[model samples]
Target: MGLKSFLSRPLAAYVAHQYQKWALHPEAAQQRVLQELLRLGPATAFGRDHDLAAARTAPDFQQRVPVRDYEALSPYIERIKQGERDVLWPGQPLYLAKTSGTTSGAKYIPITKDSIGNHINGAKDALLHYVHRTGKPQFLDGKLIFLSGSPELEQVAGIHTGRLSGIANHHVPGYLRRNQLPSYQTNVIDDWEQKLDHIVDETLGQPMTLISGIPPWVQMYFDRLTERTGRPVGEVFPQFQLFVYGGVNFEPYRRKLLDSIGRPVDTLELFPASEGFFAFQDEPGNPGLLLLADAGIYYEFIPAERFFEPNPPRLTLAEVELDRNYALVVSSNAGLWGYSVGDTVRFVSLRPHRVLVTGRIKHFLSAFGEHVIGEEVEQTLREALQQFPEAEVVEFTVAPRVSDTATEPSRHEWLVEFARPPHNAAAFAAALDAGLRRRNVYYDDLLRGNILAPLQLTPLPAGAFQRYMKSQGKLGGQNKVPRLSNDRVLADGLLRA
Candidate 1:
């Protein structure tokens, strides 16, 4: 190997060694983490200790806590909204991550110092492990780019001071903090539209080797970059080597991004939220993400088979079966104990403890009582796309809507966009319908009764989702397209001419 490759090999080896050591002894690592959580706070620690103790004593400790939705925690969330300090934890929270959740409106998720540290450490582990696997030098010895949410600190009565993304940004090492692009002091909050334009314009010619953000916003930024430079994105910023994305799935937009850049780029998916950075894709070739089990968070999974049941057992990492879908529940250092964030995941393998995100538990449609899930929809789309190689769905939303004419009381509508006019829209829809029916029997019955009409293939004008996002004041920074819509109002608004 050459000098640069030789130097990187040893670093890669070191990272791999660490990852292997952790993987081999996850229980030991979690036990040590439990001790640390105890040190953080008695109540914070006591909750976990109680659960563990309960698990040890109960016939099936994993089955004790029923699968709960966010509604279960609404009362506590309301207490936080009312300015209560110790509602979730012992002391005043350090910050709140303002996230625009589906339908429930904006939620100010509390984040404490311990939780912040967990996020940082989890990220560090992921990065170190990556360097070890690839043996690639950290391209930017300079600044790192993190296209994050608005850093506006909320000043609500009794609410925390710091914004989630901003607080995380602030926690970066003092020396590296200055290297952050878009200095935190700029009033990028007041004029979001102008700010996005400025961010795109200013960074056009910079030596930014790494870019990270949500997929939708990144696409918008690239679109703007291409417009501004009057050249393809790759020509404007050829040096960018790595793109790190988190908070949403990037699979659907992968091809578009590759086309824009003119070449394949290294992409890393991070499983992070306001709660904590739970996992990351350890190696580019790995099938599932490696969980940061050592982070100050305890994880549980509700098996897919029991997901809709009134009370589904919550299995720990060890108790969970491999290759089955499960709803993720987390008890973190952020004071969220036995919390179900609504995201769904499945284990691709168990020996290495790697997991793949299947879908959001709440983002499914089962109006026919068939229990259709996000994974089923994703799989159906994947199969349909493979059959019709000429067609590409730019954006889509699936929902149960009744026909206004009352002929079909219950029918499913899919608002979809194609790259260009399909050779046969009807055939494409039929293929999708067949795929769905085969994968989910309930959908088949619904289709037979015309309860679910032939999937409506609506061709969205180019940049339609982008335009919608801009109108919603979420043009840039960590915002993504709504993958599934249950309500008719938002769906109709999105579909309207």
Candidate 2:
């Protein structure tokens, strides 16, 4: 669609107005949102007839309808799997985004036209806000390289089959869509070695102004680029301006990528999922992520402690407190009602509704019942790295595995990769152990009682993480290396020497 057509809709104006109102007077915004929810037939419309009816008749509508997770939507997914179109929505879905599930193998997430529009608008809002903040929209007007998944549509009967990234790419404004690269679409399930070769050849001499993708994939591309050209990526892609990434944490890989590029390029973090586009890094140099509150989706934040609770308090965006971590729950126009996206975040402030992503509620190490998250582990590692400037941890994963001694039960083990041989491996391990202990009291206690073993450093050969990515069929495009493993299965198999 034309830029004017895309921007001139009443929904766009309404979203802008609501955003302003919510930013300024949050209390009034809450009441207005409640009214809007009621007016929209919260339970009746959008395939939520049962929920709407129950909410309307219940004494406390909000309290009665508890928050739900993807598992809770299994029945709906089963219906779709059984070739039922109207199970999720009142009509046939336009597309289904296929994503890897932690346990369910592959999940086909439904998306309606309105939901597609919502995602597009949310992305547009992020771009507009970034332009307003940096006054450099033209910086992004150059060739934008999106490191994405395969664009091929899987042929599945009675199921929407296209990749979500490909669908969104096709639907962007024509003007802003001109300077884009060809996506990786040869084989959806090929090994990373062949894919990496193809991606490197395609991007070598291109005037790439922006690089966007998962950190691990981006690093792989740069590594291959450096090897082929015998120079760092900065010398190769001089026009590169921004590096946008998401789907996983960026902190661990940030230093390496920046060093490889040989300069401080603009980096943008986006919190998007197969379900819908959730949030994006709006302003440069700001740690807080802005929420797309008006993207035709309502947000709910359940306290981190309530993640596994039978019933958790669902706090609306207005009721959510600042500076506290919360598990994100979303109800989008895509027919997902009060669905938990399995992500945890904390609000940095409320005036503009800025937030910081804490971690995934499930991706944590709780062997000693400390509930250590990915962020905590990264932070501790960063602190340790700071003290030993020469030390470089190329790849690492933390897991709670059974201890060697039966009586000890379980302990947190860190599989670490280094650039070179450390002067003192034992000392380095001690430092890391101390860092973790100091960061969290539970780890400290575990260490004293020998519940958690000393930090183990596995001196992987150079290019190990790269090799691991290559083995996983994820060397190129938007795949990220798994950061945390709850058990030794992946760690042993993937990181085996």
Candidate 3:
């Protein structure tokens, strides 16, 4: 047997055990996880402050610890950074999963050994669970190329910190190290352009079987490979069997992605973040991902409709209803207590719970009180893009234009950089506007009342958004322009580009 296969035996068995437990008694698994977390560091400052030892139930724990974001957790995290032991986790974090997600500026998220192990093991379970269900392992027989972020980490307050993918790349299993493409030197190139070129050069001749990354970055690699080989991606890597993707909604990029790859391949969607790896598409037939309830995270849900409220009632898995959007809050082995991950999702199934990521709680255009969220915008645009089949959306951002004078009324402005602009701009704009109005009652009401002007669309030059991201040093993996924003910072920057 192959070395990877041999090493995978234990993991496969572990996944099997977890799957059985998840299927039969998921709630029991959650209760056990909570107990473990509470018992781990009960004497630490945070633990004692929250009275973790006294908290015997989920409700009691919630009552003890208030929901907080990174800013609120900064004081404890700072202490952890200053070489303090048993601050958040039992000891110092393995590294920090640095990011600039919903809130502005760089965020240094603590990644304990417990948390990083969960990240790696969660991915293993995803692969093993899929193979067990589908009985397909052709992809495993050949090399797997992960087009991800830089692994060359730098020190942050005596702890290593970098992108989550960068940090995880080092921990790749010894058995599969040979099967992974692109040398470590090539993988750590900081410049996106240089890194892209290096990756293409190094991986062009490899016998790739599986390709994994965020959709947009993967699309870039595929496009570049086609350009270099003068052939389709399927031809270039004929053995390619799987495409693993996450980070953003795939609907907008789906058509172009398939078109670039030149054939259908098995696809798995993951809900992985710096904080935790939450879900994965375990079955090809299931449209939503099976929530990894047994993973290290203790999940909570806040109704998106009332998410902005100062103290909205939260629900546990037993109380959540299907088809309702909720802001995800997680208390994890990572030492993040009652932290909102900024993503929103809705349950598609109740038993053996499965969910679909709907949108981001902060990514919305509601400057004029017409609360238009990322989910609504993405859905509307996906339907609208049907009218322009030949055109493909590359990148897009939306901003609210709050006018102070009556002569210049308020409206939402859309800045789109398309691989192929539509034949008719006016029709595309009209279709997009009509779709939004049809989907959102608040938007329709504003249009009817003339409180907001019809949305405007500006077709940016081909590389405008790319250039902007490059300027900000966030061009590649997991770094993306917020699709909808309440402010004009991103919109103005795109215009300047």
Best-matching candidate per lDDT: 3
Q: What lDDT score goes with residue 485 in model 2?
A: 66
Per-residue accuracy of model 3 over 155-204 as CA lDDT, tens digit each: 97789988788887988876668888778988877555677788889778
C-alpha RMSD (angstroms) for model 3: 13.8
lDDT of 2 by residue, 1-497 (tens): 33433443544455456567666665454455444444454433333644664454222455545576666776776676666655655555677786543333345677876688876776666656655556455445466666665565665555557656666766666655666664435324244556667777777788777787766567767877888998988889897877887766666567778888897777778877778887788778987877766565667788998778777777777678887889988766576766778778999878778788787787766533344656667877888788778788778878766443224435567777787545788777777788777666445544553445676766667777777778777787997756666556657765663
- List the candidate 2 regions with Cα displacement exceeding 4 Å: 1-22, 25-51, 54-60, 155-157, 183-191, 364-497
Worst 10 residues of 2 by lDDT: 38-47
Note each model's CA RMSD in angstroms.
14.2, 14.2, 13.8
Candidates 1 and 3 compared by TM-score, better number: 3
lDDT of each: 0.65, 0.66, 0.79
Whose TM-score is greatest here?
Answer: 3
Where is model 1 more than 4 Å wrong at Cα? 1-19, 31-67, 83-85, 102-104, 156-163, 185-187, 364-497
How good is model 3 by TM-score?
A: 0.74
lDDT agreement of model 1 with the native: 0.65
